[model samples]
Target chain A: MFELQAPLIARREVASGMWVLSFSAPEVAATARAGQFVNLLLRPGPLLRRPFSVYRATSGVVEVLLKPVGAGTAGLAALALGESVSLLGPLGSGFQLDQAAGSVALVSGGLGVAPMPLAARAAAALGLQVHWVHGARTAAELCSEWEGRRVHWATDDGSIGYHGSVLAAIPEGIGQVVACGPNRMLAALAARFPRAQVAIETYMGCGTGVCLGCAVPRTSGVYDRACKEGPVYQANDIRWDVLPQHLHYGLGA
Target chain B: MSGLRVGGVELRSPVLAASGTFGYGTEVPLCDRPRLGGMVSKGIFLQPRPGTPPPRIVETPSGMLNAIGLQGPGVEALIRDYCPLWAEWDFPVLVNINGESVDEYAELAARLDGVPGVSGLEINISCPNVREGGMFFGKDPAQAAAVTAAVRRSTRLPVWVKLTPAVSDLAEVARACESAGADALCAINTLVGMSFDLGTGRPRLAFGTGGLSGPAIRPIAVHLAHQAAQSVAIPVIGIGGIGGAEDALEFLYAGCQAVQIGTATFIDPNAIGKTMEALEALDWRRLVEGTRAAISSG
Candidate 1:
């Protein structure tokens, strides 16, 4: 819960709108849990604090995957290496990892794969054989790279490893599924297994629970906040059906 | 004597971070705020409300409007989860409790009673409720008094009424809260504002109308703060367009004992701590004397 102004160590353009930002936070990197996010305050105007899930964390470096959709991320991507940005986080409740599970598979889409790279490493730490299954529009979008962990790639264009959605190739022995992506992908995965923990993204006013801008409906006929109760939730717990049917992410019951 | 004795509690610093702007105590990221002041967390309602749809905020000229709709996990969640975290910190994390019904507000206030981390309550009366609740309690003097009286009786914690500038008679409402035994007053919540989306011909924000904040509302906020301070003997905490110590000084000069930092924190979460330091560094007594002499000579 401590706030420290961390020095930006490295910033690289991963893709057109995608960026890889690394900060020096040994305490946060060493102990930051999966699915927890850090709120990045972008200076100037129009944009304020933006919350991005922790992508991957090294000994003293915490990397976040960001898509520059607005002024905040765009400004963040433009920061110099030695520049310091006000970051208050390693916040919000992260993914719920079940250690006793035998076979584990990770499903992700677009920049939604932000938390999975670290989750895979954590799974390896738990001695679980993990399979990283990632889905993107094409080969260019699959920016996730795992060194020793197994990764299975899928793209919509038939341009990558698997020529279909990652949902289509859920391993037969998968005892547990962890996902972060469009709501549609999560719901589809949920419908397939009716079991999986998913990280939901909501454009929040305050990435912390106080604002309550980021809330999703739960099966109990109530809404659960993304910042507090979960950035992650079990498939059956979220009320996907109650969501407006317009967004591409939450489609499919 | 420096500690502000507002009703039942004494705030070490009169200044506080406005609600809905600062997250929980931990969300602000300062190692500690034993120096600056206190933090007012986002609004908490009786039940969990999904709130308004997406595109919740829109930037206007020198301001930003937000119709966040009091999205929250209910007041119980705040007590159960957020309070424990606040207890770990040294500063008082005041909870801003809101609700559609007086009973709901009372229930929330009752729930917060005896909570370890809760220092006080700031009642936000500007929440544009879509449910059974007609409008904000602050808009109507009678209702504001009733709500304030109810929450005041429900908890022993000091109660502060956060007034919205949208009301017709701001003095009437501020006076009502004072009569109802409010400890302090935070005048001028965000003003109602809107923006257009030429691309889709729809409103820029998913919610049609949003609360306007930032420099655009500063004058109006200061005006209300001055008026409210004059109307009641209780201390008034000015809010709006307070991006720095200079802005805060304006509010203090206008008669508010303290001021809050809102929209500015979005750009720099550390704006509060930095501004606090900058203000403390100034020879305020000498500056005040200089300004007094100038005003007298002029």
Candidate 2:
């Protein structure tokens, strides 16, 4: 892990309220894995650092996809080109692929798609056939697409491929699954696919396992910090029933 | 730039990472550990605590509110799991011990007294004295003194009593701890405060209220440190909203021998290291002389 000031290289509004921000952070980009994240400082106010999953990492740059839901994220979205942001990463546990599985399904919902593209690329590099299942509230919110792949889509309204949810769009014969989305959606995926490794999100303090603020209760009765023990965990390891119900996603309604 | 002598222990730097914020001092691999003077581990209780529920933290205008409820793996687990690693570090590792009663406090101190990895103990008297009906020990001078005395008797290690700003007369509490045998004093734990979420028609944090820390509380902390330093002879280690060398300088000018970087670690995990670097670049003799000159002129 490294803490460095990353200069903004590019920014793109991928969806209605979502943005894909690229930064020049060679050290972080060099060490970051598929599911690891970076914690960015929101300055001038709100002393707490906000955590963003690595959307993509290339030669000497890292990208983070975020939706401006609160003041911290809004500050990030408002950053101009060439501006610098303090980044602490590549942090937390990333996705662990099963080498034995010939194929895998990558699932995401809303801004959860932040980590999917990289995960897909990583899984594809391992010679595993990758299937993408992504969903959002609407088409405008769909946010991303992978070129030259068998991609599936779901939306709350009938304007998308699947009329209901992404959970229903998971095709059969996939030996492994990796998902990131709302707690409810992740829980449903866990219930349907016991082998799913789902990325969990929670409010964090230190993001280094010190504060114990972002603890997610596990099936064995021990609390695991999403920032430390995992931002990713196997389906059976989590106790979804006890997980907090309401989360402030920060996307303005 | 130079080390500080706090009671029997000698810290390599004057900037110690405050408890709760620094974790066990081993979690952040990215941080440069040797740059820190020392680090106080998270609060350790007699029994394990699950801490508060989700939304345990909320951002304020210039700081943040957090009611982590002292979540920890209990003293036994800490000693068993982390002591060996701490023992190997170049810097000191002070355990911040918390309890509900004086006896419990003494027991924890006694247990850590001769432990190889442990350097000292910071008695967290800000916790409620449950036997006395939820009154914070730090809020009552008499109770604070009694707890300090008991812990002092139980351990040979240097004891630093952590004070809370919620009390009316912080000087009296500092004096009480000193008289009862505290080696040093940590002025100002997080000030008890709360924030409301107007949109949800409810409190922002799940625990309703939390300890407020960061730049917003710096002035208040400085005032309290000044008062506590004036009222006691023991070394005062200042804490609360200390983000950089400038902030640490305020406490030092107020008579604090050392300062702990707390909330700033949330903003920059390498805050303590950076503050130490900043302090190294400063002319301390001039800063101190200037402050003294201003005081004398006034």
Candidate 3:
């Protein structure tokens, strides 16, 4: 992992309060992969670095999607253009795209969509059919700008796309499924598709293995560091029932 | 340019990574190992520990609270898996030994005593998050000295006792450790703290309370380190919320021979090296004399 000061090369308000920030971190962007994350150091209070999934990376520029949920994130949203921030990343294990046989399904719920665009691109590069499935509470909350080949949308309020929770809308018979969402959503998805790869969420400090803060218990009763052993792990390997079912990201599950 | 010796162990610089912040010294790459005096490994016990549950850390104002419960792979794993790597590093690596009893502390020191990579021992008598042993041995002068003396008798390596700020009399404990054969003292571990999640009506950390460290605790650390230094002749190594050169200078000015970077490493992995780069330009003799004058005048 590399740590460097990257300027705010680009920023956009994607949805109501959600934003997409792009930084000029060549070394970090050069090695970033799907499901991997970057820890951005914030200004002023809340001394710890905030961890965000690598949303996209192109031409020495890396992007991260975030909603101002806490002090650290809100500080990030107030930064001016060209302002530099410390970035440590391309950290943790990424999604296993090569493990797929033929087709790959990228499933995301709400802010869980943060890592799917990159996962979709990585799967496409490997010559696998990429099927993107996204869900949100309503049409206004949906991120429809995914540049994937085929996209499916699910909304709880039925304002657009498939009705009901995203879990009910997922189709069976997909070869390999990679998912990121609230722990409650991922827990249910894990039960349905026991073979799916999931990104678990927990409060983190250091964003490296040393702190041992973002630990998630495994089925074997051993706790694994989410920032090191994985932000991505095989679904069935996680002891989902034991995880506290709370929305870590601001967005709903 | 500025190098010093702490408790007889010669160091290349005065900036060391605090225990629990830098792991077994294996995870940090060579490129990040900038001009560091040394690094203290994470606290280890007699057996492997599972640590606390999830949500173990939470960000407060200018600091963070953590209750990691001293999760580690035990003393044997340290000698087998980590020591070989430490022996090859450019800087000295002190093992931060933790124990539930004085005998346990002595056994840990004995096990690491002549190990190739192990340069010294930093007895962790002050850990607030654990259920037993930890801060218990640190809060009382007799207990703290007892642990220090036990470890001192078991090994030939330099022994540095880490003090907890939770104690009512920080100087009493400092002098007791020095009298008990401690070569040096690391003053001011994290202050005990707690924060609640209003949404869930529950404590943010799974362990209810955790040790608070970061910029918020820097001033307290400086005061405590200064007080400890005044009470004893052994070199004082200051720690608590040290993030930059300014923070390290405060410790140095308060009579600390060296300072350890803790939570700051989480923000920038190169914090230790960066602080060292700034410290390289200082006149060490003047700094120490200035500390003596300031302390005497106060």
Candidate 4:
């Protein structure tokens, strides 16, 4: 395991507060696993490493989604194509895709919808029937739409699809559910589903396996480091309430 | 505060930011760089280290843990990409060099030979050194001394040795680094700590049991810094549990020549800047209080 600072090989403002940062790392891309994350060692001068999900992985590049919410993201968003930055990755454990998730419902909030496009693509390749749900505080926050999948969007203000949350919109018949988002949002969904797969967030350090810093309580009675044990976790496995009183990414609201 | 010389350069303050936490100085916002006594950069190895598996970091209350595994482009890559940047900056940039072997250490030191932007060297003996039977050279005085001696022989740059607190006798290692012609010392690297997931009942880290950091490890850092400072003649740069200026002062009172902010940067990049501001405020308060007392007595 290692941590690296990759430069911005290409970046473009895709939306109001969001941009696509393409960093340099070949080994990371070659071994890129679905649902894995890399701690983008951004403006440590301005801020420390910021974790970003590997949105999509190619043979030589890993695409990460960035929302210019803070100093690090803001600096990252301003990078011109080919401007170098540091990226230490591909860090953390990722999703354990179950071809057994025959009929599944995937849920996320705003940019958290990241790991999905590839996940849906992966499940489709596995021939698993999939249904997807996306959430945002507003319609302006939503990113891409899955082409052939049944996509649902929920906005807190009712700007998009559902009025409440994905948990409320969750159709009752699905056997397995997968999700990612704010701790509260994830917490609510975990509280609701209580048996779905989930992902958690935290500020990061080494992005490798040496720092036992992140924590995720498991339902079966265990605390796991979100960095190493998961960015992806089985929903039923987490001890939902043990999350930090103040979660990362200013997502608590 | 006076004898702040390490190797060849003299520093104004005994505190220096530790490597891996502060990138080559420039990584910090420019406004705060001036207050830092010095900056030890992310670990530079012989070859670029494409660090370990993902989820490299996890934040805990008052601190953060990281398993960056000393990720950086090789020293050459650093010189090509990061050094010139460091040269232009006003704050001193001390490069922390890491390797799996003694020769690698010496070789890299030699390669760094005349790089202009580079200031001094931090021997990251916290890692394994070759010719030491795969044992972490930092854990043993003999290996530590041998590795220090080798690197000392290789470079004229200010060489400061970084020690890990996980070892049994830190004093022995301190003395070893001193004997090996080291200039100054960075005390207490990350303490070996880990957590596990009880659900799957598996190890938490893919590498299992990563380093524990942040406020949780502060007291231990202070204890080690004091002990190392007492044991060595060289200046001590204390790192660990340093989330703020008071924590940095705690190290200073314990006798550290300089201090580093590690996990603090994860949560607040301005930790060093804030701490410096806090210290100055305290300094101003002390100055005023002392003046008032003198005037009253007179």
Q: Which candidate tops TM-score?
A: 3
lDDT of 1 by residue, B1-298 (tens): 1455543555555556888778676555642275547778888888876677655655566676787777777887878888988778656777888877898888888989889988899887776534445256777899999999999899998788888887888899999999998999988788877767655666666678778888888999999999998899998889998988888888877877777888777656567877777777885445655776777799
B35-96 per-residue lDDT for model 3 (tens digits)? 88899999999899989887788888778889999999999988999999889988899999
Q: Please rank every candidate by lDDT, starting with the best.
A: 3, 2, 1, 4
lDDT of 3 by residue, A110-161 (tens): 8899998899888888988888888899989888568566788899999988
Show where candidate 2 strays beyond 4 Å.
Answer: A249-253, B1-3, B127-135, B293-298
Error of 3 at B76 (Å): 0.5
* Residue-level error in angstroms, candidate 1, position A113: 1.9
> For residues A111-130, could you state the per-residue lDDT of candidate 1 as single tens digits?
87888878887888887789
TM-score of chain B of each: 0.92, 0.94, 0.95, 0.88
- Rank candidates, DockQ, best first: 3, 2, 1, 4
Sort all candidates by TM-score, best to worst: 3, 2, 1, 4
Q: Which window of ten consecutive residues has the lowest lDDT sum in model 4 chain B?
A: B126-135
- On lDDT, the leading prediction is 3
Best DockQ among the predictions, by candidate number: 3
Give the TM-score comparing model 2 with the true structure, all chains together.
0.95
- The TM-score measured for candidate 3 stands at 0.96
Q: Lowest-scoring 10 consecutive residues by lDDT in candidate 1 chain B?
A: B1-10
Docking quality level of the chain pair in candidate 3: medium
lDDT of 2 by residue, B1-298 (tens): 4446885678988889999888898776656676788888988888897776667877776777787778789988998999999888888899998888899999999999999889999988774312321237888999999999999999999899899988989989999999999999998888777777666868777778888888889999999999999999889999989989999999999998889998788667788888888877896547867888899899
How many clashes (backbone atoms < 3 Å, residues ≥3 apart in a chain or on different chains) does model 1 have? 3
